[model samples]
Target: MWSTKQLADLAGTTTKAIRYYHRAQLLDEPERGHNGYKQYRAQHLLQLLRIRRLTELGLSPASAASALENDNSSELYEALTAAERELTAAIDKFNAMREDVRGALAGRSFGDLALQLSDKPPGLSEKDFAVLLVMSRLFDAETVLTFQEILHSSPRTPVDEAFDALSPNADRKEREAVAEMLAEQTRTRTPENPPYSTRGQGLAEAVEIMEKSIAHLYNDAQIEAIRRSWELLRAQKTASDT
Candidate 1:
């Protein structure tokens, strides 16, 4: 016979974990001795060891209990296979995220734009990065790729860089000049209709989400520039379609 602490030590686990198993009813609690101390037997040690092994094999507590109760049966095998599949999927996801982090740190462009995000762009802030991340979630892969192409191909000027640095307190003349420049630049380039724009039902919701994000991320002057440019682009696209 052994004490609870002794049994835990023998099984290479903590006394708290042993107690947890007892509370979970995974391990049977031993009866108290005449001296009023709980006496643990070899059977208890074996049960604890089995439970520990099952958990180490990636089985949850409930699954481990089920696996043990159904030992040497088809149920046990099925439980183990399910656990193995979950572990494999978790590892695959972790590896993919690891690769994305590596790509970001190395400043490498990837087919997946989310993975290629740098800590910050020279003329952009974390707000811009966050908006892109949200867009990735809301849009399909093809739409995101088209957006990336437009971003890369669009012409940049000193005015655009200055606009990125604009504050809410920017004067009216500064805002108008920036908006006019941006509108002219947007008019000269052509982009595919975004996926959201074609969704008659989803368009309003998508626009609301994107506009909210823009409001949170950009100052008044910057937001005005974007609004002005979008208006011009919409007019140009309308004319071309006619």
Candidate 2:
């Protein structure tokens, strides 16, 4: 016979837990002696040990009754298998997260441009990204990559750089120099409908989306440079017509 504290110590659980099990009917109540002191017996120890074993096997207290009555060995086995599967999944997730953390530490730029376009690349605005997604669908992956490179290079004049590097405040001399260099550069890279041009419904949407997107990022001088660049193509086409 043992007191509640003694029984708790022997069972390696708390007295409160033992009392809870008593309320749960998992542990039978001990009988009170004439001195009004209740004492726990070996039966109590056996019951608590069984409860702990079942719980360690992942059986819920509510389901313990079901476990006791039926041939739940198959259920217990299934539960253990399910627990193993969950553990495996958790490990896989941890490994992936660990790899990501390592990449971040190394600054390897693991993010995908096509998928995570709206994020990481701070140069592009939200509107710019939406249009780019359309471009991915419309253009070949190679073409899209080429365009990304082009955007990074982003033809700029010596004058534009000098002014930007010096001060944002515009000057006529610098502006003219910028315009000349831009015209020269744009003349070289103006869009020519190639054999592999992305055409049809998607093409129109892509073009429209792209135009609408960058409408604000470029200034009037930049826009003029682009128009001047297109003039060469227009002139050639006009000559052919004549």
Candidate 3:
């Protein structure tokens, strides 16, 4: 027989832990002595050791109690299996995080674009990065990878700079010229058959997000130029098909 402190010391834990075990009903409450102090027995010490062992194995207090009550129970097996899977997943996640950190230290960008792209396109603006970040979440990974490849491989031109610098109140003539240039560029660069899927169950939501992003990220003239360029491309495709 010993005091609570002695039992805790023997179990390589703290008095606070012993009290917590009592509240959790994991350790049996011993009888009080003449001085009204609890007297712990060897049985209590063994029980504390067992509970600590189960908890160290990643079992919750309740699960540890359940495990103790029935050592060969299926519930204990399931708990152990779940703990193992969680630990394995956590290890993998941490390893990936470490690799990302290493890459960043070596001057590589990581995050929304990094997973799909080796590096961002030259002269990619903050607004473009924000749009790509949103797009990464909206589209599937493969689609994003394809988009990144296209952006990386396509060279920027004076027309791109003109479109970017277009004012919100730019005249229709300027917008149409920019649109025609863009449509021509798109025809030369874009594939006749796109390598990525644009149709899916989430297509409607994806389109809504893209429309909102475009409206928020670009001015009126830029948006008009984009819209006109798309229309021109469609018209050209229609004529070719016919």
Candidate 4:
């Protein structure tokens, strides 16, 4: 039998911790001497060594003490392996997304333009962007990836230039030219999943907000040009519906 201090020295822990372990019922109560000091024997040393071993293997103190009985050591090993696999998958996906962002910056031009155009407040409202973000959530990963590819197309004409250019004082002819060009461009590359698709035929509120934000960007004559082109677009849609 060894004294508490001797046991603490041998086990690399404090006598107080040994006492606490006994209180926790993890270490069995040792025998007491004539003077009433507790004496720990070989059994206590072996149990503590086992506790340290299991602690090194990621088990809690209680689990470490009782691991032989609970069958959790193998389970912990498998859980660690599963977690590693998930982390690897996440890392690979992040790397792939980074490559796409790099490619879209130059190779996939329109996609980059959309991001640039969206940099200003009310230029491409966060609410509108939020609607686009929601569609990505609703679609499958492949569909969302395809939609991203569609955004990379270059602007087809001078109106695309005006729409993207950030000048508030663009003339009526310039704005109208852009409106006509955008209408033709939009007709050519109509999205299979439009932001307004979820709203179906009832897109008045969404269109109003978008149009209002855009209207505030240009002068009175520019507004008339834009309004006429938009009316032409509405007429085309109405004729198509019939």
Per-residue C-alpha lDDT of model 3 across residues 81-151, encoded as one tens digit per residue: 66555554566554554443344334443333243322345665555544554455466555656666666
lDDT of 3 at 142: 57
Q: Please identify model 3 stretches exceeding 4 Å from their true place.
A: 1-123, 199-208, 238-242
Q: Residues 79-192, candidate 2: write the lDDT tens digits.
A: 445444444456555454444334433444323223221232446444334334445445655555555555545655564464344333556555555555654554455445
CA shift at 191, candidate 1, in angstroms?
A: 3.6
Cα lDDT of model 4 by residue, 199-242, tens digit: 23244544444344334345555555556665767777888889
- List the lowest-lDDT window of 10 residues for candidate 2: 111-120
- In candidate 1, which residue ranges exceed 4 Å CA deviation? 1-125, 152-156, 171-173, 187-201
The TM-score values for the models, in the order shown, are: 0.43, 0.33, 0.46, 0.33
Off by over 4 Å in 2: 69-71, 83-242
- Tell me the tens digit of each residue's lDDT in model 1 across 84-117: 5566567655454444434433445343443222
The lDDT of each candidate is 0.62, 0.51, 0.66, 0.51
TM-score head-to-head 1 vs 4, winner: 1
Worst 10 residues of 3 by lDDT: 110-119
Candidate rank order under lDDT: 3, 1, 4, 2
Highest lDDT model number: 3
Better of 1 and 2 by lDDT: 1
The TM-score between candidate 4 and the true structure equals 0.33
